[model samples]
Target: MVILGLGSNLGNRAIHLKRAISRLSRGSGAVLHAVRLSRIYGSPALTPTGAPAAWDLPYLNCALLGETTLEPGALLRHVQEIESSLGRQDHRRWAPRVIDIDILWWDGCEIKSDDLTIPHPEILKRPFVLEPLRDLIPDTILDSETVEAHASRAGARASVGEIAHSPDADIDVSYPTLMGILNITPNSFSDGGRFLEPETALMHARRLVEEGAGIIDVGAESTRPDGATIDPATEWARVEPVLHGLRALQGEVRSLGRRDPFQISIDSRNPSTIRSALDIGVDILNDVTGFTQPEMLEIAESTDVPLVFMHSLSIPVVKGESIPPDRDSVEFLISWAEERLAEFDRRGIKRHRLVFDPGIGFGKTAHQSWHLLEHVERFHDLEIPLLVGHSRKSFLRTVTEKPSAGRDVETLTVSRGLVEKGVEILRVHDVEGHATLVSRHHSDRLSQLDAGAAVKP
Candidate 1:
């Protein structure tokens, strides 16, 4: 049994809910069981009303119940389609929405995916949703706490009430983590061909480890939009030097003074390259294939290691250094990620061992990138820790009007926003600068948060 809460503040709110439930009942993947809706709650508009008549526009909201066999992600897509069908446009941020459907509970299962989070985040913060949902699933126990108990304990009517994941769900990723990037091509926008020399590459590898990189991502094949592809041998040659250098550093760390047993990651889509890296001792495979490739699944499961699954519009030519997303974007990338994660799970890939990357700067316009960053919190719903790799992206330069040749300062602006959103691993080339900025700002933010929590009336 699953409990879904639905609401709409736009055109014909009640009608939108009715149509949404009807469509969900008949959706290709879901089964509509039963529904218990709350009395429609009306509230003043949150977005400032420019027109004198706009202030009178009140928002309508409600809740629901159902039984379905669809996975969390599949259910999400169906709901999104229903919302769109009911006249919900994915254009506004915090604007009037139509037929917003949220998964309140699913057969007592806990799920966190890139696009969908079960139990619905913000459940503990919205009395409008929780009050009605509580009436429907009167005895729902999430994480050993009753829905009523959970809702009552938290301030459901707080000013900030938008939920990103279920109240009981876990969204914490390892914070202050490190991710060292490797670009295996002669023309990557950043370090293109600079590390081609085995000696120079080895030095870079050692330096990254010394500074503190929990995972070293070695890219043997660069997949920049319309980027060049090489044969298996060429791919292997590029990463081999760096891989060997990492091994040498591993040994030296122990002999000299430090040893973290840092893990090594192979960033590639070719099964052969992945297999070869595995044979030589790679710990993680960052597959941009979206796990659509059968070989990717086989190699990952066979190795029984963790995998970093990244989402892309196409398998190639992520956002070029030439183009980017725009402002006020509506492309909900996290929601999309949830759907992709479901795809991986259906293929027998373990969710716990999987890490999520929002595929920043890949196929996303400038607006899309901002939407991801602004709501990076929404991704915490996936539960698995996340990695952000938007360092020196063209979008940053385009937005900040900084030159892309080396926009370290401009890129840092985005990084700052991400860290505030609780992003775990920051994939970057400027290790020292990132660490410095994070170290300085984290203290202040932590203190401010603590003070806010302590000042309760």
Candidate 2:
């Protein structure tokens, strides 16, 4: 079954949405099983420049469930076509629209691409989404925390009056327990240009696997805040060798008796890159952009690949030389990221395939990173798997009184702490050390559980 979330805040909002859903139901290879409407939410528009601007419109949201033979991406295109027919195009950032049809989740599939990101990126943050979602899936928990807990944190600033779903269908997803960070830039402060050397990158890959990494991430560009930027060709060059090595490593690891070692993730915000990676054997995509761009969601909706939809505070450059990452902006980093993540979920992308990240050092100060970690559990309510890469990060060194290059112990220690806070992946250089520690601890726990279950039972 696929869940489609609908929204509108323009002329004949309700009618526009009805026409869109009706078109969807009457369209090909899809059936409408359930529909849920939340109380209309009227709030000022949120512009890219970070001010409460006027959309001169109201927003109405709803949830829908159905089964479809059309692949998730195809279905997404179909939805976009409907929106276009209903007259929705780029006018303003949060300007009113006639109708928006977003596929939140497609059964148990995960997709990441330029055109679409399943689970609609904005679902997590908007009360407009959660309210209707709760109406239908009251017992369904999307975050690690319970639904009530997730709701309570939503506060009253956002208004989403609860509406009802007619004979609500069962919506559920069992998430995989793995997260992989794919940093693409050669200048990413964390890894530097190490992965640029394919051989050296393969070594890191091997170490991750030996250390219990379930996925090997491949990035072709960098999004480090206030960090050096590169062109697409440059980004491609950086990741191409490593990507080839990664594919070969798949076979190499298999030959070494570690079959199905780990999935490969393409870390990129560019749709072109997403297309290029998928052309190869890339298994997943991790986009740092909030997926506010309709094209981004369009790319993801066009495929069924797993996606890691991140939360960032700002709208990234569409196609320009972005200024380097901010080295000393904590609130700018955390709050922006928090809002981005929530908005991304609200827009599209399912909660299951959707892994969240706390941007760590990107656009963040060292102290901010520490504060984010301190309240990292707050993100657990999103229910998506968390990926924190403190490996050789400045934060690790800050706490350890060492530089980023010589802080393996600090990195490992932070990794341990983050995992306890529900982080699923630790993107780091010292994978072997971290993996070995985690594996041993896990092994002992299993042993203890086995011993307890076996004795006199």
Candidate 3:
């Protein structure tokens, strides 16, 4: 029997442990079967005097007892790969991490190598590891004492408790959420002039919510390359009626017993339009222009709502003179986004409430847009949830010989890739397709969790 201790002290601790367990169950050189697992425990930080401040966070630790055909050294390599895949980084000892996996014991076999040591040197002395290991393997003997005895002896020194992962605990990152597009403008490239009327727009918004859209992005003006921009007053007039209707819909959904109401986002760059939408209580502001205006920053400072700053070299809806010379699209995007984010920091906007969109088709050439999508994971360094609006953009049109409406398949294809790369919010035109895809993905994870939870002592 192989036993591994898993722990995480940063960023959704429970999800990290569960994710590691799930990955380990899959093949890693040799097939590994999860024989039994222990309940997740929240433990106090193991901070010595010389530990860094990052070790201040508490850790969620658990133990997994499994059967594997691979030898100890090979298994150690596999576990290290899994840790790095789940966002663990090389940092100082006792530093907080996204996930940490240690080979507590391997088949009662003792092995020593430069890279790893069997029966972890201090495993018996640590209550966090011993407690969970004892639960899975009740009679497990470590060093000269039984697992239970070691845990009992050190239990008084450690603060630990059983905890389960919430259904929505990993909602922000584990699963890709669909943000349905609700363009209320008459000049938008897709769905423009379709739902300009208040009732029609409201009906479509309701349909989006019913179809499993976590967010409904109601854009007043078109941000297409060849679209025209209206003044703030004209823009607000277009979206005002629809906003009022959706505000009422929010109450209706809540009265009908929905716990977390669907979020509504205003997709515009004008300060006046943002102010009007905020006055009517919009949940998020998605500025395609990166929120560069002084008044826009002022509004962000005064409001506590989440804001999305899309990366674009020029203002939306207006065609740029020419595409920039070929270069590393990921580097360019990161640099541009970082500079914009620094401005937000100076404006006193909270980083926790900030979301970054890569601006798929805002101003880039067809090649540039595809390059950005291909390497979307590069933006995870921003350390926040990413919003990808790849719903029927010009990039798809260039790849496939299809019109705007016919590119839903391409959009779905890209959406699946983004979902796999940990893209959180996907703004799409086809809510049902994206929602169904994400729903099934989340369900598979849930099933794995259910199966793991069933593993007891």
Candidate 4:
């Protein structure tokens, strides 16, 4: 395990840092696969006592935890080459540069050499380093104190520098993709009986697309614990008309000169319903059962659409059930996802088309669900896109005490956190609210980046 500290203060700092990360991940002959990335921290640049005022520009800093096959010396040389490629020049000490990558820690080894140092000598004194390091490993013991403890102490010092922007303030970053929910069932949890009619569902689908949904995940069966269990025929009956209506709507949009409009996804576990939806034309398949059944796998093998394999212990999700207490939630989830990926690979399904969902509120206690949200970054190690559907679920009620309809505020709040943690897609009910949240966040990030770029050295 190695932790590398990255920072930049000149010429679009976010871009520099991102480019450096990309280069580092592809080290020549020595693979450096980043497993976890800390939240990007913006701090005032550190300069020498007699340095020019122009050198004190604010910098975007972050730490990356990764695994590598190279030794300390080779790794240092590799990063130095990456730095040179990214336009890093070492003309003077503490000088502003396009990129800076330092090996912070390397497999708990303590080494002192003329070229490199393990456990960076100034790691404890620099709050910018500690702040992001704490995000990756809060409880790591350093200098006989936890990283979190050191961060707190360094943070209290007035000279440590103020945080200027949130982690998502990057001009080149991809914002969270929105998956709009269209429930055709009359007993769905959040909007049950609201859009049961085909016309109403079609209108709502159009509204969702207008509000910024890249995909509309249409479901005809309610998967809630106490919800009714319908047969494949009943499910298809509810779903068929909506699919046709959506296709017609797509045609209408294209006729009006709209090209490559929103995608359509079927959110059902029933094999019959899945086949019918795919027969008509659905861009994605969202299996709440995680494709455990042979028929579901057969359908997956037949189609090339992206598959959302959500983790659930049961279909309806028995109430009061949760992952075993002895097992770690994040580890369990990653393991389950890995197994699914392996299964898909053995069956000749392209692994790249798979997306994993933690299945929040399904067979999980409120606390367990919240814990998964807090440590959501761990799932990124799977190297697959993630989709989270925490929209107005029972978990939010644990804190907001609001019913399904009233949890939009809480839903938006949690969605923001999830976006910050770098989740790829968000399956949401309130498309407008999530859309507004995403738009505002992107606008703020652009403003910050613009301000940073305007700074003259």
Candidate 5:
């Protein structure tokens, strides 16, 4: 096992760290295979006495855990080459640089050489290093104490901040945002009849927001295979009151000083329902049928709101129907998405306003769903946002044998894997559980790091 510390204080710091990790994963004849990455953190630069003010710029830092086939010395030289390739220049100690890679630990091996050292000398004394190191190997022993213990002590004395979502940061490095599911149908597969009443639905929407949902996907008609189909008027009836209540709720939330209020997405495929939702001022449109309908295409052309285009074989999916056995599911979805993008482009609909969902569990067997998820990275080639709605789906229930309402844990497990693959959004039933998982994985120990203090070295 190998652990490396990465930091950047100059020139698009997040990009620098991302590029370094990419290069390390592929360079050196494939010597380093990254297995995990710590959440990115922001910290003040460690500068020498009498250094220029420009050298004191803050840094974005993270830790990478991986396996290496090369020895410690050879690994050191390779990383140094990577640093230089990313525009790091030989400069004075603690000087601001484009990128910095330090070999923090190498399989408990101890060595002290002129060029490199195993188990970085200041791991225990630096919060920036200890915090991210603990993220990867919390219980591993370091100088007679666990990495977690050292991190606690170091954090108690130092100031570190998580790299929170900002306008300029690349979405690839940002944590996956949550879209809480709000099904207001009596016969939906999960939580059926629970929020059929408009009042109940509004309360649940508020709860979802409190639980950390950045978007509330309100769907009146359930699209599950066994779900009952409803007309546009019926769907609008179920959804209208909830929409008004949500607008009022948004006003309430905004009055409380929340700068970025949660967005509202209407999840439906019916044209009338979507038109009514647009008239009601919803922020996004989620179509389960992938906009195959002509009226849906007309709506897309008329609206500028972000649209979620899901790939499914049929609405309220037909059982025993799925991608052909001989077809590659991932490739099939990619082709489908490309064709959709082309059609939208030809119609003058901007590509940037689009998102794709592989439509897990819709017209797919358990095995097919899992296969598509495993290779979801292929969809990134589309260069648009991806939203995955794997929450409480039958595919997960196959593994845990849990009912729809009981599959939150399974949903989170899969959601974490999606987050690692850089999926932009996760549409989920349990917003709180998924939120906690993302917080721990992407911002572990952020509270301590964000506290105003300095490492007592």
Candidate 6:
């Protein structure tokens, strides 16, 4: 176990922390693996007494927990080299710098050398460090005090608050991720009745996660065009059991030594379903309604679940209707999304907690659906993660002339293309194939990067 602290108070604080994390993961001959990063926290600068208050700048702080095979001294040297490469200039103590990396604790080994110390002395005293550290390792004990207790005591004098993470604090969507579709509706386009039962849904969900799904998108009501829309009570009845089962399965996985957290995304536009899902601890709310209801906004204020605003012409999509081909669909969607984003901003929803889906088949013809996929990267300008659910949609049917069950190949093709264009989340029914493609795509890119770096002057 290697625990490290990263802090930056000058020059693109978030970028500095993110870059350092990447370098740390790749450096040291690939000795480090299984990295767990905490959400960034903004902490007021710790200045000595009599220092000028105007000169102080708050630091963006985060903790990193990873498994590294390198010895402590070698690991320290590797990190020092990373900091130097990231432009850490020598400065007076506590002064703002581009990047600062410190080894908080190393493998429970005590070392008292002039160059390095095993457990950082300031861990117990600084709320900034304790807060992020506690998030990553809540059971950590330092100087006979738990990290949580230390953070609580230190938070009074040293204020620390978590900033919104780009996609989410708990989820890692830095690369193309697999969001497995778990539809419980009898009328859903694919795999509907198969998972309507709680026991069957739990088994399938466990299989999805085991097959490398980063998220399980649970939908009780069918969002398919012309599909039936059930009442909130019916929707909850189909969803509540699955959520509870997955939560229990998560505990079982953890007990069996799997530490990766599986995120739950509830797919519904109903406010009552949203409330119930939040109460059961859903990580994200995927609304096909684009959050039009006042009740939706009210829920946003009441809970902190991240919102997914999908573009659709109607709440329950009307069948056989497509945006007019004569009309510029992309332009209309851009304007419509901008308006929705503005409304969310007005409602005090943080930008980081919001993501947009183009609603591939919701209100678009096969051609119009393809238009959205081709211009998907345009949504990047919105400055939030983009989720594309092109899996087994009708557009693929138009291209391949195949049924929904036979479109997995087309789904992988579309998914790989979206991943290349930097789509953050790929919601698909075929988790294994999508996961494999993403893994290979990233691996090949990394290989090219390494080869290019080796030849550079």
Q: Write the per-residue lDDT of candidate 4 for residues 1-457, one digit (tens) a residue.
A: 8989988887646646755654555223334664555667788878879899989888888777778888899888888876775667764768998788899987779989888888999999888899877777778899899998999888888463475335344322235668999999888888999999999999999999888787899998888986778898988888899999888877886788644467789999998889888889988999999998999999999987889999998877788778997888888888988899889989988654677899999988888899999988677667566789999999887788678889989998899898777677899999899878877766664454344321100
Please provide, for model 6 over 1-457, each residue's C-alpha lDDT reduced to its tens digit, 9 standing for 90 to 100: 8879988877546545655665665422444566666656666678899877654876777777778888888988888876765668665776777788899986678888898888987778777788767666666778887777777777666523533223222223235557899988788887769888999888899999988787899998887777776999999999999999888877887798643467789998889889988888888888888888899889987776668889888756788887877987777787888899899878877665677888898889888899889888777656566789989988887779888988999988787678656577789999888767756654553353334221000
Q: Point out the worst 10-residue segment of candidate 2 by lDDT.
A: 167-176
Deviation in Å, model 5, residue 340 alpha carbon:
0.4
lDDT of 2 at 37: 30
Clashing pairs in 5: 157-454, 157-455, 158-454, 158-455
Model-by-model lDDT, in order? 0.63, 0.58, 0.76, 0.79, 0.79, 0.75
Candidate 1 lDDT score relative to the true structure = 0.63
Name the 10 consecutive residues with the lowest summed lDDT in model 1. 165-174
- lDDT score, candidate 6: 0.75
TM-score of each: 0.57, 0.52, 0.66, 0.64, 0.64, 0.64
Top candidate (TM-score):
3
Q: What is the descending TM-score order?
A: 3, 6, 4, 5, 1, 2
Shift in Å, residue 310, candidate 2: 2.6
Instruction: Give RMSD to native, each candidate.
Output: 17.3, 18.6, 9.5, 13.2, 9.9, 13.9
Per-residue alpha-carbon lDDT of candidate 1 for residues 160-208, written as tens digits (9 for 90 to 100): 5343222100111113456776665787777888777777777777677
Candidate 5 — worst ten consecutive residues by lDDT sum? 448-457
lDDT of 3 at 344: 80
lDDT of 2 at 431: 56
| Regions of candidate 5 where Cα sits further than 4 Å from its true position | 1-173, 445-457
- Candidate 4: count the clashes: 0
